[model samples]
Target: VRQAMVLTNNPDKLRALAAGGVEIAGRQALYGSLNDHNHRYLSAKAERAGHWLDEVLDTRSSRD
Candidate 1:
């Protein structure tokens, strides 16, 4: 659960990280050199991530 939580939180940052295929860092979904810099600059990243967390983070039945 914690692993899922952490991976989902941090977006992949290629420059800042290595052994790269896909990861969560820079707090935004990054591929290639192109990146969505968090909603304002990267609305898609924000929306997708927000949606993902929304589905996962709901307290109603999450613990189950």
Candidate 2:
């Protein structure tokens, strides 16, 4: 299934799927903020939930 495949490939999508399907608001919420708050939240989700957040995680490490 395309939906399942997409979900498997994308951690954000997986989360969206789990949270009663993805909506426009979900997309906006994810990219709405680029501050530490959103960054940390995304990092935690990646580490704890196996989300594909390499781009954000890599940036965090580089900043250190």
Candidate 3:
């Protein structure tokens, strides 16, 4: 299985992507260059996604 993450400030776009079977990792409200907060937020989101992916892979491996 493949997972996708979308970084957008628009709620509509987020919803549309989610409706389209895209997994929403996080939403970015800030525009332009990334600030410390945005960076931290994105990092946390990525970490969470990584953990989730690890769990999925582990499950699949166990099944196999």
Candidate 3 residue 20 Cα shift, in angstroms, is 0.4
Ranking by TM-score: 2, 3, 1
lDDT of 3 by residue, 7-53 (tens): 55445666677787877776544444444445555455436543222
lDDT (CA) per prediction: 0.34, 0.56, 0.51
Segments in model 1 whose C-alpha atoms lie over 4 Å from true places: 1-8, 14-16, 19-46, 49-56, 60-64
Residue 38 lDDT, candidate 2, scale 0-100: 81
Give me the overall lDDT of model 1: 0.34
Instruction: Name the regions of candidate 3 deviating beyond 4 angstroms.
Output: 32-64
Per-residue lDDT of 1-64 in model 1, one digit per residue for the tens?
1111133333333322444334423344223222234224333444664433333233324455
Worst 10 residues of 1 by lDDT: 1-10
Clashing pairs for model 3 are none
Which residue pairs in candidate 1 collide?
10-24, 10-25, 11-24, 11-25, 11-27, 12-25
